[model samples]
Target: MPYYENAIKKMLPKTYLRQHVAHEIYVALTHFQSLVPMMDKYVYNDGTMKNLMSLTGTIPVMFEDNTYNIPVCLWIEESYPQTAPICYVRPTCEMTVLSGKYISSNGEVMLPYLEEWKNGECDLVSLLQVMVVVFGDFPPVYMHSHPEPEQAPCWLQFHRQAEVLSRTDGSLYLHLASEDDLPFQQENETSC
Candidate 1:
């Protein structure tokens, strides 16, 4: 049997066949538009009954006033519902290619909700919402105007290895790059 047919068949209790599981799957995919309000999820059903779909949506960027259009493909396995749908983020011009805690350079997203995906309770629309947030939080580093690696300023270089927090609450800037004192040196000691 094809993947979609198997997804609907194996997902439900063996005894409950007929139009129950298939009907639900059909309805969910067809009515996804109404579920997710923020992003527009366009689903394309492949011919036959593979249960495979290609979804595309525009997600707002968190870094600045910009948006990125991402292409997500859903592959339904035989153990779907019990197992979450395999989602992949495709490459796009609007998005800068980078990997982090939430996403990979290859466009793979690691969503906590997906791990806790509950059948009937959770749908693709909900998953898409989480996807949008994750994508937004981790914006493309390239989008920022960062100095070149070799010619980067001292503070910028330090920012990469360690945390360089910037705040504007009547802040006082401090730097300890002093040559007057050697680190862990005797108070009376002097350099010749």
Candidate 2:
């Protein structure tokens, strides 16, 4: 076996990183085969993935614990590699960062930052770090009143429901609300 295989096998048995649903899916897709090829094609080619992995490393894993510990579901699709991954966080968990935010199917936040990054406003690494920090304290409710319907650009509307997931327990999950779904309204009500 190659070095990466040995490393992954050892990492799998030792850390909570392997618990991520994405990892399982990746493993299943690879079927014990070398992921370096896929990684080279799908992950490495995408500048965002390189930045993400550089920041979080190969595992790119997170964990949440409460009454019951559960893995956050996150997946990556190549067709939309330019966009962030879709993620889903358990609703029952106390981490509210991702609970109400609209996310893409691949669990990436549809923020203007990505557009700015693409425009050369910043590099991928800085963009990724900024995303991590911004989402780290993300609010449970997204206040849509700020953007006027007529003034909102097509891209904004297109990705309106996309949001990055961040867990208080240091895990992250991405989720996207359906476009047809009614927009979220902010109320004084709080989840108990």
Candidate 3:
């Protein structure tokens, strides 16, 4: 049997919902075969499969009936090697933006970020290590942030105001000011 058919069979004892999900996965896989390989050495590795199975054991396996509930679906696009597997988080769930940046439910931005990290010569082990480090804790405040002005109205006036703000106890302001430092480091640490 195909992977989707197998998935559907496995999910038959669970709930009708999972069957639908399995079908969808199967359809996506079939339709996008040219885009994604049948097997991924990195994502489908034994370790990775184990991790996914672990997640299935704990996390809510059934898709909740709610506007804010996002269905976690996996898809592979042509960008897999250059990018990351496209993990679709259904838009039903409300995603909170930590600062002010907005990430879509389709995982567009995440793909690029993954690509950059991977293409930067980071090996799969190192990539997984970084992923564990970054995603394990999953700081709530690191999701999204507010967008800043594009032109800043005027550079000179903006800098003057920025300088004044920097002089005072503007930690909150500073924290929201830049996307680079939104995480707010302690004692000038590089790692978040």
Candidate 4:
């Protein structure tokens, strides 16, 4: 909590235009305990960089009676609530991005909730809930089955949705199952 408070204060200083932004961010973090706030330098495609505040971590997704944690990073703009946060699916080295209707090729999340966000009507918590629901239907990531030949590791196209479930006991387990015969895969990441 102190970490988030300090990061927000340092990264996004108080402003009359963004009076409620800090409080809103604090509330969202409190509700979504899995997400941890941090300040990082964000480099845009144009090569411009800016210090940005991001909530990075995983959110739980339930599938076939099991739960999986999906990694994500949300970058809050200075004018948040007035502007939608830039959201991305931050897949781990063991995971691969599954680009589809909800996720872009570069792992940016493209949801109707984000597209039609309204300042007063939309909130961070609600956006996350929408992500959970939408991702349940269309998962944004899958375990990378093969290791890269050149020393770096990283896709598969199938009708079936993939899931990576984490258990209390540590283990590296993966299940490639279809909807009718759906089994759980193990996620190696921990929640905040």
Q: Which candidate wins on TM-score?
A: 4
TM-score between candidate 4 and the true structure: 0.69
Report the C-alpha lDDT of model 4 over 41-136, residue by residue, as the tens digit.
877789999777788999998766677899999988777778899999999878889999999999999998889989999988899999988888
TM-scores of all candidate predictions against the true structure: 0.44, 0.26, 0.24, 0.69
- Over 1-192, each residue of candidate 1 has an lDDT whose tens digit, in order, gives 445545654444443432444554545455443221111243434634443333443443444566655555555444555667666665443335577876667666667887788887876656766776677776533433554555655454445332233437744333232232233333433322
Candidate 4 clash figure, as a count: 1
Q: Name the regions of candidate 4 deviating beyond 4 angstroms.
A: 1-11, 15-19, 146-192
In the range 1-192, model 2's lDDT, one tens digit per residue, is: 545444544443232233342343344334322122122222432555531211112212122321222223223333223444433332222223344343453334555665443422333334434444444444222223344545645455566565555657766555455455553443422222
The list of candidate 3 runs beyond 4 A from truth reads: 1-74, 94-113, 117-132, 136-192
- The TM-score that candidate 1 achieves is 0.44
From the highest TM-score down, the ranking of the candidates is 4, 1, 2, 3
RMSD of 2: 19.5
List CA RMSD, all candidates.
Answer: 17.2, 19.5, 18.4, 14.9
lDDT of 3 at 170: 40
Model 4 steric clash pairs: 165-185
* Residue range 1-192, candidate 3, lDDT tens digits: 576567544633342334443454455445333222132222442456311210000112221232121223333333333445444333222344222222343332243345564543532233333432333333212222443465242333334322112324444323223433254444432221
Give the CA lDDT, 0 to 100, for residue 182 in model 1. 31
